[model samples]
Target: MKADAFPYRAPWWLPGGNAQTLWAALASRRHFGPAPRWQRSRWNTPDGDFVDVDQALHPSAPDAPLLVLFHGLEGSSASQYAVAFADFAAAHGLAYAVPHFRGCSGELNHAPRAYHSGDFAEIDWILRRFASEHPGRPLLAVGVSLGGNALMRWAGELGDAAAQQVRAIASVCSPLDLAAGGHAIGRGFNRLVYTRMFMRSMVPKALKKLEQHPGLFDREALLGARDLYEFDNLFTAPLHGFRDTADYWSRASAKPVLHRIRVPALALNARNDPFVPANSLPTAQDAGTHVTLWQPAQGGHVGFPVSHGPFGLPGHVRAMPEAVGHWLLTHL
Candidate 1:
């Protein structure tokens, strides 16, 4: 109903903001259920390039709720959150599908265009397409980080005219203010560690993409980008038709439009999220009537860690799934 602390507590063991942020991404904890079976499918965009989808079908309910998930930057079906949530949905008798960003599905996308934080076109297409294919099933969406930003932008852009077929929306650890997020990740050790981690995977892809459109981008200057802003400036903005990085972050951010969302959308951000500062988050008044902003005190970037059972079996990994499952139980 309003922006509030989402009944989640960070365990004492997961000290510091960055620790919570990195633990889930780095921890090798095993999932505690039968593995989900996925069908790999491709959706050809209006353009020639195609995006990929990994669908986790519901075992017994064809008309069950369908959860369409979008992963964060450089994330695909293999992302921890994606796999966890897909398993959660499937086990709950819900069908789930994960749509990979333009080039993240282990394949280079068509040229002159790539995925960005504000790419609502593809998300809109996914929602509409799923609703058409399923006919009467309820629809929901969950986006993490970059995907979260894109989901919020799409819902806000749609406003009251937003698709009624879509019943609810949830965004986890998204940087609604793209500029703020960019600033956060650009400074200090975050810049040193996170930026490099992103670029390690990103640079090679850009290099590979450049092979398709040789001489289109600066051969050396583009290759020398040291941070997210530089990367966006050299590649994302120009390739996707933005004026520059600043313009791209400004126009692509979802904060300014949060008030326009018409559906019961939830924005979950860890106040201590390493990538998005607490000040950048919205309050209930700022988010308008349609959106709920949940600011948990200590979830790192995409990490929401709770205590483990006496045996420390699943650890805090279950926190996110529990929260999401509870929210959906009430919302649906």
Candidate 2:
């Protein structure tokens, strides 16, 4: 789909990227209405770890399309965007599920390894399990931020094989170019605000991981790390088997493998997204014929707050998900 055809316009009341991004976290829930009920299930991983998944409580037809959401860093099923998408799926008579990455789900994972942006093996396992369980049901997947990059990597790695597992996929505000995004988030106001916000939870999680497996990484270095780059250097890189921050960012990036995706895929990003640099976003040529790029001038890292509706009235954060969800359905 074309970028302008996306039908998302930032509200005058919610100006700029930061405001839109923060509004989704702080206020979009109120406007989007109450969150839908969720049913939690724990799945055992092949490596003896457990991951929790939250499925929307609303019932759909037995053959209804299943929408699986892989959330951003430090995000869960209860996240504002996840709840909003649940509501959207319910409204459209679709089944929805949100799978939490290790360490992000309330409880820290037992294994010393943690999830990362290039954790496509984990994504492959999760999606394949979902496909197997649902048999003939059509499956659709959407990954937000970190999850998106991983999901895309999985699709690219598997190539045409992915077409059998999922009908379509969408990535919202994902940092496709991890190197660009990693350095961007560690500098300027992004470091002060967004990076700090993520580190608060991440550092504690890493500390807990250290406690689980003593001497996993340096204690003082982990504590002293100021930004994601430093934090990854101290903790994430070693735990996930990367040599260092540089190696992790480069290899984990989804940009280089975009051309390998054989299934229909949508990569949506805002030019002004605080986390993903505009220059790093993929074009049609970069992503290949099967992938579509939607680089709106606004939306702010999965925060697309609309000002006007079709009736010329107020709009909410549901606009982006609804549009993306419709796009996914159309591909099916």
Candidate 3:
């Protein structure tokens, strides 16, 4: 499938990359209607840290399709995209789960390790547990940004084994090439806006974690990181056992292994995404037969705003859920 199969057009009122990217966390928050009651489950890892999984299900249905959602950098249950997707899934009577990365589930996670862009082991644990708990239901997934990258990487690495776990998968606005993505978001205007937003949430949590596990590293160096690369170099790389940011970025990127994926998957990205450049977006040939890179020219990052809808309701309709939801509905 190509981008033409599921066309998306941004509303004229909200033009440009900045408008669409920022609106979800700003203007679109007020439009969130009644939310689903998400049952929370916290998993304590062998490493002493923990991750949280929030499940939103249809009360009447004992068995339903499950879409495991993975949020972006520093995002949680309250993140604009997560909340919107949860409610949207509930409205559609789909069973969904949102797994919060370590140190991102309201309270600080224990131990020295935290989540990174390529935490495939953690993702595998979550997927395995969910599959076991649900038994026979068809398992699907939709990952946003960082989580999307890891999910794609896992699929690529697993090859045929992935098909057994997930029937189909969707990844939105993920940084397939971590080195390219880092360079794009680590400089110029993105450094000021996007970088600041990520750090604002990440830094506090890092500091708190450092306090819990003393003598871990230099706190000042972490506080001084001005870009994504620098943050990885100063804290994430060392904590995760990588030599440097380059090492971490290169090893964690999904681009190198995408061709190995055997499960049917859709990789959606906006050509004008602020953090990921158009040149870095995957081509159909690059993704092999199992994957398609559906990139629209205009939807900035994960935002696909449409002014008109079924009842003429106007707001930023999140494309991640719309595309993934529609695909899962028909494919499953």
> TM-scores for all candidates?
0.95, 0.96, 0.94
Clashes of each: 0, 0, 0
- Location of the lowest summed lDDT over 10 successive residues in candidate 1: 28-37
lDDT of 1 by residue, 120-193 (tens): 88788888888888886788888999999999999999887665758888899999999999999999989999
Misplaced by over 4 Å in model 1 are 28-30, 309-314
Segments in model 2 whose C-alpha atoms lie over 4 Å from true places: 1-3, 30-34, 308-315
Please estimate how well model 1 matches the true structure, expressed as its whole-model Cα lDDT: 0.83
Q: Give me candidate 3's TM-score against the actual structure.
A: 0.94
Q: Between prediction 2 and prediction 3, which has the larger lDDT?
A: 2
Clashing pairs in 3: none
User: What's the lDDT for candidate 2?
Assistant: 0.88
lDDT of model 3 at position 305: 67
Q: How many backbone clashes does candidate 2 have?
A: 0
Query: What is candidate 3's local distance difference test score?
Result: 0.80
lDDT per residue for candidate 2 within 1-332, as digits (tens), equals 33555856787777788888988777664225456888889999999999998888888999999999999998998887888899889888899999999977788989999889999999999999899989868999999999999999999999999998999999999999999999999899999999999999899898989899999999898899999999989888888899999999999999899999999999999998999999999887779888888888888888897654565334467888888999999988
The residue pairs found clashing in candidate 2 are: none
